[model samples]
Target: MSRIQGPEPERRLARLFRSLAPAERETLLAFAEFLAQRGATTPEPHGGLREPIPVPRPTTESVVAAIKRLSKAYEMLDRGPMLNETSALMSAHVLQGRPANEVIDDLEALFARHYRDYRAKHLSEG
Candidate 1:
C-alpha cells in the first residue's frame, strides 16, 4: 500500500499563515472558521458579481493549471472557503496519484457551484 499522506496540509497552511500580513492573516483565519461552520457553503468577500470571463480549458491541463484557470474565470467568487476542498484535491492528485483529468473535473464543478451561489446571492439582493 502507498504510504499515508499526512500533516502536509497543516504545514502548508502554517506557511501560508506566516506569509500573510496581520489583517490578511485574520481574514484567512476567519474564512477557515466560516468553512468549519458552514461546510461547503462559501461566502464571497465584499464585491460585485459579474459574468465569468470565458477561459476555455486547454485540451490538456495539469490540476494546478486548471485551478488557476478556474480562479481567473470566476474571479468574483472568493477563494478562501474553497481552499480546503481545493487543497484536498491537489493533495489527492499529487500524493495519491489520482488522475489529473478527474481532479480537474471536480475542480471545474467546484468553481461553477461557487459562481452559481455568488450570482444567486448578489442578484437576489440587488
Candidate 2:
C-alpha cells in the first residue's frame, strides 16, 4: 500500500513559518500544543529540560562583550521591544552587585521564559 500525502505539504515549512504574522504565529503554536498533548505519555529522554548551567564568576569584560553581540543581533532583527536595553537594563542587572552564578541564573531564566512563552503562545493558538 502507498502512503497518502496531504495536498498542502510542508516542503517549504521554514519559509512558511517566517512569513507568519503574530496572530498566525499564535495559531501555529496552538497546533503544536495539540500535538504535544497527543504525545504527552512519552517522556523526554533527559530529565525534563531545564535552564542552562551558570559558570562560576563570569568576567565583566566577557559579559559586556556578550551584551554587545546580543544587542547587534536584536537590532538587526528589528526587535527592540523585548531587547531589554542591553547596557542599562538586562545586562546591567547581571553585572551589578551580584555573584557571577546568580547573574547567569537570572539571565538564563529570563531567556528561557521568554522563548517558552513565545513558542507556547503561537503553537497553542487556535
Candidate 3:
C-alpha cells in the first residue's frame, strides 16, 4: 500500500488564512492576539481592546460616553454577551457610585474577553 502524509500544520493554517476575506483576516489576527495573551502570567490590564488607542477624554466624560467609545472601538465584537456585562457595570457606576474610570476599565476587559470568545467560536466554525 502507498503511504500518505498530511500537509504540515503550518501549511494547512496558511492555506486556511489565505482563503479568508480581509475582514476575516482581521478577525484571525485578533484571535491570534487572544491566544498569545492567554499564556501570559499577567495579561495587560487592557488586553487587546486598546487598539486604535481610545482618545483620552476628560475626567468629566460620562460613563455612557466611555461605553459608546469602547463599543465603537471594538465593533468587531458580538454584542449580545457584552450587553449584559455592560449593563451591570453601568448599574454599578450609576447606582453604587463606582468610579467612572474603574467601570471603564472593567468595560475594557469585558469587551476584550468577548472579542476573544467571538474569535474562538468563529475560528472553529470556519
Q: Pick the candidate with the highest lDDT.
A: 1
lDDT per residue for candidate 1 within 25-80, as digits (tens), equals 65456445534434332344565558788999999987766776787677666777
Using TM-score as the yardstick, the better of models 2 and 3 is 3
Candidate 2: TM-score?
0.33
Give Cα-based local distance difference scores for all models: 0.74, 0.42, 0.64
TM-scores of all predicted structures: 0.63, 0.33, 0.51
lDDT of 2 by residue, 47-76 (tens): 233233333333553333333333332222
Stronger candidate by lDDT (1 vs 2): 1
lDDT, model 3, position 16:
91
Runs with alpha carbons beyond 4 Å of true place in candidate 1: 1-48
